[model samples]
Structure formats: C-alpha cells, structure tokens
Target: MKFPEVVSVEQADQYEQVIDVRSPAEFALDHYPGAINCPVLDNEERIVVGTLYKQVSVFEAKKVGAALVARNIAKHLDEQFSKNPKEWTPLIYCWRGGNRSGAMTHILRQVGWRASQLDGGYKAFRRQVINELEILPGRFQWRVLSGETGSAKSRVLEGLAAAGAQVLDLEALACHKGSVLGILPDQPQPAQKMFETRIWDVLRKLDPARPVFVEAESKKVGQLRVPEHLFEQMTQHSTVFRIQASVAARVDFLIEDYHYFLADTDTLKQQLRHLVTLHGHEVIHHWCQQVDAAQWPELVGDLLVRHYDPAYLKSSNNLFTGFATAHPLPADKLDGPGIARLVDQLLNLQG
Candidate 1:
C-alpha cells in the first residue's frame, strides 16, 4: 500500500472532492464544508469498537475495527467511487486525522488514486474557521439594519443580497427567526459550531473593501451565538439604519412572515408559553385564547406592541452607538416591490 499524503487545512480547497471518513453522527454535527461522508465504521460499529477497546483489548478492537473498515471501504470503492478517472484527486478526513482516514487514504493510493488526508482532520478545519472568524469581521465595515420585529429589516437585507450587495442574513443561517417563536416548521437550527462555520464560510468570500449589510441582532440568534468580534464590530463601529414602517404595516408584515405558525396553533401556543414569566400567566393565557380563535392579526399586533417593540427600542438605544443618529428609512411595505424600493433607498444612503 502507498503511504498516505497528509495535507494541511489550508490546502483543503485545492481538491475537487473532499471525503469524510468519520461516523455519520460526527459528520452530521460538523464537517469540512463541501466534504462528503463515506464513513468507514458508521454509528453502531464505532460504539462497538470503542467498547471493545476499553473492555477487551486494543488488539481485539483493532482486529474487529479493521475488518469493518476494510469491508466498508470496499463497498464504497465498488459503489460510490468505481468510475473515477485517473486524473481525479480527492481529499479524505476523519476526527483528528487518525487511523480511519489514514487507512482509507492508504487504500485509495494503493489503488492508483492520488488521495490525500487532511492534516489534523475536522479539528483543523474548525480551528481555521475560529481564527478566520475572529479577524474577518473587523476587516469589513458593517452596516446594521436596526428595527423592531415586523419592520421588514430581514426582507430589506434579502433585497440587498438579491441585488448583489454583500449581506449576512443571520436568521437565514441559523434557521430560526431570533425569538422563542422563531423556529421554523421543519427546519431545525444547525449546531452552534456549524452556525459559526456558515458565517465564516460566507465572510471569507466577501470583499472586505465593501460594507457588509446585516440585520441587528442580540448576541444570540435562536440558540446560536454570534462570534464576539463580529458582534462587537457591528454594534460598536457600524452605522445603523432604522427600517421604519407604521405599526399597522409592521403587524401585517409579521403575520405574513410568521404565517407558518398561524397554520399550527398548537405549536404556536406552546412557543408562547415561554413568555409567561415576562408577560405573566394571564397574558399568556389570553394569547393562547387568541390562537384558539385564530386571531393572528390581533395576536401579532399585541406581540409587537407589548413584547418586541419595547425590547427592540431599549436594546437598540443601549447597544448601537449611532442608533440615535440612525438614518430613518420609511418602508411602504415588506413585499417584494417594497423591499426592492427599500434596497434602492439603502444603496442611495451608501452613496
């Protein structure tokens, strides 16, 4: 068997196909971006091998684990990678760049495929993401879009992105709308590491010379925390734009954005239960009754009036230095045309 060639995390992008040789559960948590899983031991098999290593002996574990790894790799070679041309080069990785990836890399090389293993594996990619995230945020001038819930700030940010402006849509990345009720129907928020990786991935490709447009957020979006440097630069050094709309307009927009919750009142009421401590039991019960009656407009308006608006006003004033002198942008609606017009107004502000 040819010896495995180990490549550093920095050289990861040089390959067209990056294969992860870790267990599926590990890959599901976080992996190098664009890396495909071709796990050699799978979930249950890994547990069996680890238990054997502790209970029996390293020799016994290796004997069984190697057999399993060889069987799986042979299956992948026959099924997933049989037709690769001689010029096709691939990178493989495992947790800590250990024996799992090393064995596979050796096998591939021996088969006349020039396969390389990632040095230090997924951990190295994570470290690179962390280090890059720390520096990348300060490199760009952030323009923070500040507004209460339902003010169409997110839509406006989307419009900017669609128009080819550099934007970081944190809610879209997190898969939660930044509230207790923010969870999407079927889309769960990613692991916190994956969230940071996503941010790092987007930030690395953006032009630092241009301002990055982002929606104002608290330290956490859903359960995902924003990187400290990125949050600091945005609140401390960025300019703020108040995306303004009338309370009526805001209520309408929110009803539309959160329409998914409208269809599933049981889940909506369950999420509303989290507000009992802040809003009190009576208020929470009344909101639940509104849900029972399908009073979406009223409930959304009440939420904005009693919950989101005051919280936003206090937070925005306290957090953003330029919020007092923030540019007021009156958005007619949060619809496509309105968002497009808002983007035009925002770009004009840039000039």
Candidate 2:
C-alpha cells in the first residue's frame, strides 16, 4: 500500500481521530488540542534510542528502535485501534511530522484504514496559533471589567456570560486568579502553547459585532503571560465597567469564595509568604498568625485594606487608559443575585 499523504493541522476537525505519536513527556508539554497520545516509543525507549544513536551508530539505534516501535505499535493496535471501523480516518502528528507519526500512518493504512500525517506536525500547529494570536485580539471589540482584587470581577464575567454576554475570562482560562496567591488549589495551569490555543479557540468563536467582556489583567497571570496583542487591546479599550463594592462586602465575598484556604492553612501561609517582601516580614508574620488563629474575615479585610487595595489603585490608574472616566456599576454584594443585577445593569447600560 502507498504511504499516507501529509495533511495540514487546519484540517484536524475533519478527521475522525487525531493521534499524537510523540513520547508521553513531549505530549504532556503540549500537543494539538484534542489529539490523543499513542506514543510509538515511550520516554525511556526514546532516551535509549537517542543515546544509542550518539554512542554507537545511527544504524544500531534504528535496529533497536524499530523493534521497540513495532512492539508498541502492536500493543496500540490491539488496545486502542482494534475495534475501529475500516472507514476510520485519523490524523497523526509528532514533533516535526517525522518518523514517529509516519510509522503510525503507514501501519494504519496497511490495516486498511485511511490515515494522514500532519504536515510539519506540532510545529505547524504552533505557528498557526502564533499567527492567529497576532491578529485575533484586534478583531474583537472589548469591554474591560476594571476593579480591585476581591471585587468579584471574575464572578461578574461569569454572570455576564450566563446573561448571554460575550465574556472572556482570562483568569479562569489560566486556572488562576491573577495575583501572588492566585494559584488554584488542585488545578494546574495549562502549558503556554495550550493556553494560547485555548485563547485562540475562544476568540475565534466570538462575534466581532458584539463587545467581549474581559477583566483587566496584568501582563502575567500566575506563570503564564497574556498574549501581547490581547493585553494591548485590553488596555486600549475605553469602555470600562468599573465594579464598586465596599471593602467589607469584598471581604465577605472573598471569605466565602476562597474557603479553600481555610482547609489548607499551610498552602495559604506559603502563598502569603510571597507578599512578605512587599508587605514586610512583620506584616506577613501577623497575617500568618491570623490564618493560624482562624481570623478569616479580619485577615481578609486587613489584606484588602493594607496590601491589595493600594496596589490595585496604582496599577489600575497607571496601566488602564480612561480609568478616571470608567462607567461605574455598583455591587452591593458579590452573591449570585447581586452579580445577576450587576450583569443586567452592564447589559442595559452598554446596550
């Protein structure tokens, strides 16, 4: 049978299955969205082949690698692809679209199923992501939600989305809250490429005619940086929905929302340690003591007044354009009903 032809990653959706033939570690780092990993050579096997290629000879390496590859492929054929219908058309890719994916495609075609390799592999998909991000930001009209930390901007975005508003919750996408202590309890952030892919996926689906409601974020969310074009567009937006809530209300909201911290005091203290340099050792020591003593509301209230609020004021005023004239949306509380009212107010005012 003839070798399968290479297809572009852009045609990914048309295929019945998308197979990633890279090593598990490579796939874990990043892969095309929705591609399933069916590594022909696992991490250790790949290392052995590579070491053999360096120490012995390319011929020797291939001799060893081919057996390992064949065995793994047989296992996959039995376990993963045994039940597939004859008409199954799968798109396969690996790093640089080279030997790994080619082997899988060849084997699958020999099994009488139509299979195609991804042209340029994961590299090509990455390039497409970069190209899309370079232009996608300017395509949407944005309405930035500008507010201090604990003012429930993320919640507001959620409520807006529920109300049929076009919302882009970057913090949620990043699996972070966008602060020194923003790391989620159990959710690890996606790889940077995957993060870009997620942003690209959302941006492509949004209607340019309608405004996309987004939070005003710094250049970085936790460890991931916002795409430059998107961050620039967010800052340039003149239509801002400034959320106003009393510090006491924001404290109450935060206490309820971040109850995870109460369960994991050590992790909470560890996160609080990051603020030590900024707030001084004495202040952080006091904060830790509060956490130990279970002074939840008082601790949150103090952090807002002393640490978060001032930082927010400076950053919001300096970084975001038209902050002085932002449209005010009063939030008496940060509960569901309050957020619903805020969402309604936003839509009514903006509409």
List clashing residue pairs in candidate 2. Answer: none
Q: Estimated TM-score per prediction?
A: 0.97, 0.95
Q: Residues 188-232, candidate 1: write the lDDT tens digits.
A: 899999999889989989998899999999899999999999999
Best by TM-score: 1
Q: Candidate 2: where is the Cα deviation over 4 Å?
A: 1-4
lDDT of 1 at 15: 84
State the lDDT at 344 in candidate 1.
97
The TM-score between candidate 1 and the true structure equals 0.97
Error of 2 at 170 (Å): 1.4
RMSD of 2: 2.1
